[model samples]
Target: MIFSSLLFIFRFLPIALAIYYLAPAKLKNLALFLVSIFFYSWGEVRYFPIMLACIVGNYFIAIFLGKNQDKPTVRRWLLVLTLVFNLGMLFFFKYTDFFIININALFGTSIGLLRLTLPLGISFYTFQTMSYTLDVYRGEVEPERNIIDLGAYVVMFPQLIAGPIVLYKDVAAQLKVHKNRYTLSEIDAGIGLFVLGLAKKVLLANSIGALWDDIKVLGYANISTPLAWLGAIAFTLQIYFDFSGYSTMAIGLGKMLGFNFPLNFNLPYISRSITDFWRRWHMTLSGWFREYLYIPLGGNRRGMKRQVLNLFIVWCLTGFWHGANWNFLLWGFYYFVLLTVEKLWLHKPLAKGKIWPHIYALFFIVVGWAIFAVDTGMGDLAMFFSKLFIPQSGISAGYFVRNYGLSLLLGIVCSTPYPGRFYHKLCRQKKEVLRIAFLAVLLLVSIAYLVDSTYNPFIYFRF
Candidate 1:
């Protein structure tokens, strides 16, 4: 049940929204919780118990932490226990096989892999629950006494699987509000944004992604340098549109439901530095690490050396958080190195430059995507890198250009801020009829594409 699917769009969403709107004000959260659990169970029913355990366990732990705030020693121990519970579940499901394979390679032990299925959104919900518990311990927010309201927050379907990673504090007030939580204007905006995102995912990302799929079928060793670069750029665009489009839809749906989810991507492709890019990309995740991990490790308060160490640890975990793959680790460290250099040296120079900074940032960003997308193992990654660097004349990119030129162009343009600016300008000019008409066309086109095409793939669902 991806959002792009006809079944979800026509069946589940319409029915769910109807049920939600018809519920009484005080029971809205209960309705939301029930519908959300059904949504999750529809996709991953086998892991329904695990999700329940997570919600129940974290709910009680947070309640306990809120109760024991006066005792520092007890609160600290409780926080530690909650961390172990959350992170332990994440590691056991996500990384157990990776550790086993590594140990087998090193010490010749044939430990059979458990190969447990990762519960969908465990990575995201774990962070959300942990943030709640941690904030309760810090006295930043009160513990949610009502388990149904807390469950509603944890399993909110829109951002549950692939998130902007909503925090508890961010929505605490909204969850408790009983009246006038939403407006007709907000619903109108949400519909427009959702249609825009649907167009982005169904039309642009899927079409551009086909070129990369073609290149993968041809194999890296057989591709020319031009085609390799094209494939990299295509993947870069595909991932951006896929994940950011999903995030946009999530945020839009949040608005429709009277919640304001935080922004995830902010024209990250336009960033001139790795540091700036992180600030824009998966922003909630970065903020999480910065607040919960980096600051606790002293951040920049202690000294340059300590700050560097803090960055290193955060990046390593950040990379691993994406997956159990070694390439992800390298991809993370790759940014760490770039960000370190930029922070210590290149920051001022990049700021001063105009065109070259964009070029440099995009060049490395594309290369980084190449690294991230090559998941077959180190051999394929090395061969792909060679194809990128060591030029070869084989299959030309001209054929792909002929096939995907318009989509590539649209993706490139949309990755910047021009389209967004145009939309805002329309709003500013009081062009309500024009805006609604345009969104209607986009929505119809996206629905047609969804009905006709079978290539819709969401990149972030695995995480």
Candidate 2:
């Protein structure tokens, strides 16, 4: 179940937390594993077994490889097999239907597609679990001996659903050595982070989500130039808040449990270049791709041309990883093209300017999300590109304000960390009046919105 859903927020989380704390320190891992299975089963009871099987399979594989690390051929083969099996499971479940449809379209065959159901966070957990096995085989981490600890590592409920893609090594120590009880300092930090994240989702992300949905629905049929640009910008903002909001909540939840999840976002929009953008946006995933895939395939350390090829492969896979859609490929390569241009031709002089760097980064990424969002065809993307430059109609500014002006403003504010930082600073003052007043207002508003919300799905759970 999605974290935003009533069942999860009210029922599952509360029960799970209660059980988790009641368990003995030695049995905490067992408690967590059981709760995680319950959490996964809450959505799709059938597929939760599959997830469990995969988890168990990987643990054994890693244990086998770790035991036989001295034999080079055996280690290599084991790692390869682990990755193949992991990705095979992910691909068959997540992309087989799309792949089958493509085969039929290409070869004029009428073979029926598998029509497989996508499991929540299949790609995410698969990658995370695979990382654990591969890293253990590589001697980056010792294979987890207790299957229960491994289970907790793979199925930690906070980052399990919508991830910052916590690496095995990053969270391994916590799994083995984590305390059962949280300190007062941990509790304070956790509460602050949780409240801030809740505000981001309930207040900011939802506002932008409505505007984004409205724009896409309208812009699909009658595409005006200005309106198309507005839609593109709206979507960019919507996805940023939606995905980042989930990550924030996950990180906050981790903190509450006395675990620290590394930051995922770092004001990516403020990046000066495409390379800088990758460094900031979804930092964990990029780091994973860099360490696991790119480096294995010969990173920039090898040579220039191979580096380019490596970059291309990563981007294409990154795109395909987003969905089975062609537009995502276009979205990925869109940045690759700009990155190439920046490196080859524009490196020396263009980046020297003040506004131009920010402008350059913003301009390219704005168009990039056009590919990411409008999934049907290139014509819509082209229309958006045209609208960004030329004004065909004045439908944008008026329509945006009329429909969701305040939300748009709130979204813009919440996408940045400024409001949260300011609030924290305000709360540190001696008088408890400000903190009291702020939470009271926030609680009333959040409750009001939650009561009215029908589109309360946490988007990243489907990742």
Best by TM-score: 1
The stretch of ten residues in a row with the least summed lDDT in candidate 1 is 454-463
lDDT of 2: 0.78
Top lDDT: which candidate number?
1
What is residue 255's positional error in candidate 1, in angstroms?
0.7
For model 2, the stretches where C-alpha displacement exceeds 4 angstroms are: 178-181, 348-351, 377-397, 427-433
TM-scores of all candidate predictions against the true structure = 0.98, 0.94
TM-score of 1: 0.98
* lDDT tens digits, residue span 111-132, model 2: 8888788888888899999999
Error (Å) of candidate 2 at residue 138 is 1.2
Clashing pairs in 1: none
